[model samples]
Target: MAQEPDPERLRALEARLAEAKGSKAKPAAAGKDFSQAEVAWRMVLELTSGIMIGGSIGYGLDYLFGTRPILLIVFLLFGFAAGIRTVMGTARDMQERQLRAQAIETQAEHSAGTEG
Candidate 1:
């Protein structure tokens, strides 16, 4: 069982939401905000999960087919591929973020030069 929503509270919430939507708030985070520390953390998670999933799949395949090492080897390779994919994607995202910041800085400098 759930509690019923209050009409007044709902209206107040709606009004607050409308005001928030109308306000111009700066984005708190962008792709560029991912630091080396953050990337490293994410990489760890990615590699761990990739290895776990790959190992599980390989182990399962091996068990099912009565193959000794083929599945494990193949799955480890798959996990490596996944890690590379994550690294590439993260690098690309960081590059894009850097470009965005550079573009913004360039625009600011141009405007300042023109004005002064």
Candidate 2:
């Protein structure tokens, strides 16, 4: 036969656990840093993919048309331009997001300051 558990000990354990949980600081900025890294990678990939796709298209057209290097060069330039454009757009979007976040943070701080 098993003995009954002590209620007093269980209550003490629960209290200790609660205190431990409450004492740990949350890593609030860790997630934001990871997301920023992801965005940067996304921008790099978008630029690289754009250039690759354009180059491939140009190569294929050149081969079919028998225009040799002429078409390939032109297409390569186009691809580079497209990639740059895409990168610029992504940068703009990132800037906008940063500005918005700053504005929100500023507003929150203002509200908090006013409250106290």
- For candidate 1, the 10 contiguous residues with the lowest summed lDDT are 23-32
- Quote the positional error of residue 42 for candidate 2 in Å: 1.5
* CA lDDT scores, all candidates in order: 0.82, 0.82
Off by over 4 Å in 1: 1-32
Cα displacement (Å) at residue 113, model 1: 2.2
Give lDDT tens digits, candidate 2, residues 1-116: 99999999987887787788885343356345337788889888988888888889889998999988888888888888888899899889778778877997799789889999
Best candidate, TM-score = 2
lDDT, residue 63, model 2: 92
Candidate 2 ranges with C-alpha deviation above 4 Å: 1-34
What does the lDDT read for residue 85 in candidate 2?
94
Candidate 1 shows a clash count of 0
